[model samples]
Target: NAGIAATMPALDYPLAHWQLTMAVNVTAPFLIAQHTLRAMRRKQWGRIVNVASISGVRAGTGRLGYGTSKAALIALTRQFAIEAAEWGVTVNAIAPGPVDTPLIRGMHGGSTAGTYASMLPMRRYGTTAEIAHAVSFLASEQAGYITGHSLAVDGGFLASGLLVRDLFEPAASAPS
Candidate 1:
């Protein structure tokens, strides 16, 4: 699910925004999976790939509702995966980092790009195709053995903890 990112501090976040975010990001997927799982169970083969986000995996400012909802989505994926596994169905989630989508473009300011570049190991926003390829793989028969996994399509964002530029710079020569 490409859920809405209503950027705001938790204190300033409105109840309606929270409810709407949860409905679209969590509830909709739940209902869709619930409805389709039965038919897939009957068929004894199926693949369900839910679109989650890196925000779910990692906390970010101004993402209280969006992050929480995607986090729920990730959990839901696991729940469905465990039950569906026996029936030859695999349920998985793709947690993509900042992708260059219209939604993201709209949300990000001019400076946001530079900030993201500094933070992300790849030093650039991910492409929609990159995210799609990951999803495609998970849905393919090749990924039959994989289930209940939230594969992060981020370009080392999750792995690059404590990314300080100063740390990477050369140390000054010791005084004689």
Candidate 2:
């Protein structure tokens, strides 16, 4: 389940907003895993991938609730992975940056979307297919050795820590 950020200052977070975001982003995943793991344990094979967000790894402008909830989800993924490994179940999270999903487009329209893209090291928003590929890999038999990992499919957004334009823009001429 996707989460909705209240986009407010930490101190301004409404109780309802925090509750709702946690309900969808964190609690839902925990509940799903609780039920699903039973069958996975029985079969001795399973893969569960939670869709977290870059906000979970790093704070943004104003995502107190959203970020917190996603962070919780990541922790949950790790905890489940450790326990489920012996049963042949893998639990991991894919933290996507700015994917070109309808939800993202709606959240960041027109120029705002472009601005967000420029901030990424790739200077472009990630495609849903890219995120899916990561999920597909983690779910495959080849990834059996991997568990309790949060794979970021963010086009280097998490690594760069600086904008593409700032990294590549031509230097201004110094006074002669």
Candidate 3:
């Protein structure tokens, strides 16, 4: 939760915050590794993929705490990856951008989400299936060589350097 803590201070207040974030984002993986390693040792292979966020990578506008926790989750994925390697287990992270999930669209709306798409080079928010594919790939046998890596399902949003601050500035001071 490095960078996110600064952005979403409110996230730190919820009674369920720690449990909510740590469950699937942290302890779930830890327990999975604890249980899966035995099978990995038996079969001599295993794959573990953590669903991270673009927020985990470049940081987001108001997602400070949420994003920071996600960033920590990414590091956790890597740490577990390194430790699990000797047991033939590979761990990876998938960083998704703004997806057309109810969580996002509900937070704003379809129109708002679409507006974000207009800002992105791809001109569309990603679908859940897109992120799922990356997870599936990482979980597949083909991803054996990959570990401690984060794949961006961002539709090029993470690549562009269009600072949002510029978009908010006056017309005369705009980047364009």
What tens-digit string does per-residue lDDT give for candidate 2 at 34-68? 99999999999999999998878977656788988
Worst 10 residues of 1 by lDDT: 161-170
Give the per-residue lDDT of model 3 (tens digit) for 60-119. 555655666788778988898888888788989888887887666676564556556788
Candidate 1, residues 61-111: lDDT per residue as tens digits?
Answer: 677999899999999999999999999999999998878978778766687
Candidate 1 ranges beyond 4 A from true positions:
162-176
User: Which whole-number lDDT from 0 to 100 does residue 66 have in model 1?
Assistant: 91
Cα lDDT of all candidates, in order?
0.87, 0.86, 0.73
Error of 3 at 172 (Å): 7.7
Clashing pairs in 1: 1-51
- Model 3 whole-model lDDT (C-alpha atoms): 0.73
TM-scores of the candidates in the order shown? 0.89, 0.89, 0.79
Question: Which runs of model 3 end up more than 4 angstroms from their true locations?
Answer: 1-20, 162-176
- In TM-score terms, candidate 1 sits at 0.89
C-alpha root-mean-square deviation, each candidate: 4.7, 4.2, 4.3
